[model samples]
Target: MVANDPITGQGANGAAKAAAVHLESILAHGDRPFDRDFQQAVADRVREGARPVVQWTSAMLEPAPEHLLGLLVAAAELPSAADRFANGFDAAADFGQWFPDPEGAADHLASLAPRG
Candidate 1:
């Protein structure tokens, strides 16, 4: 998986733009099997300046699978979370077979932050 190029030329707020891009990429690949509500809750927390741990646990209104939840939490806390997720997914032989609904996942992730 090619690492995302650092976001640049966004003027004085380059760091925020880069962070946003990183968050988008991470959420795109990392959110699997979780519902839109969960994804949105995390994205909202991120936009609202919440810590990664807070973002991870913000949207748990009901029971979720423990292992999957742990993955999401860990990914949220890492700086290179998106690259790690993409690499892991690409390395897994059965990943494509297991997740045949990437379009749906992308759509759900997109809904988290609509373009103006």
Candidate 2:
């Protein structure tokens, strides 16, 4: 779990609560294209405007770690996706244990990459 404040170490709880509120606000507004301003608002609410506060769980690993590895490989291949997942992984590592085995995560993600 990661939070905006590394010193305070609120973990994901604060961010999760804020995200729920922001999601509710978005839903209340109905289906609409989220413009940059709206997107910024959501990001600000979640304390992700400057840096991301991600909360990884067993649920995210779902079914198996392979699923996440595949997703991470795909993300690593794209600039935008890389910014979110791959970069997020680096940021998560700064605060706490990002994964049980960083080497294993890298190997798993590598295995899922498309071979030439």
Best TM-score among the predictions, by candidate number:
2
Q: At residue 106, what lDDT does model 2 achieve?
A: 61
What is the per-residue lDDT of model 2 for residues 1-116, given as tens digits with 9 covering 90 to 100?
Answer: 22343432435545556667687869976877778988776766555522333334333434446545655566768564465454453354332232335664565456555689
Model 1, TM vs. native: 0.23
The residue pairs found clashing in candidate 2 are: none
Off by over 4 Å in 2: 1-9, 48-116
lDDT of 1 by residue, 85-108 (tens): 455322322223222244533443
User: Residue 1 in model 2: shift from native, Å?
Assistant: 12
Overall local distance difference test of candidate 2: 0.51
Best by lDDT: 2
Model 2 reaches what TM-score against the true structure? Answer: 0.31
Residue 35 of model 1: what lDDT?
69
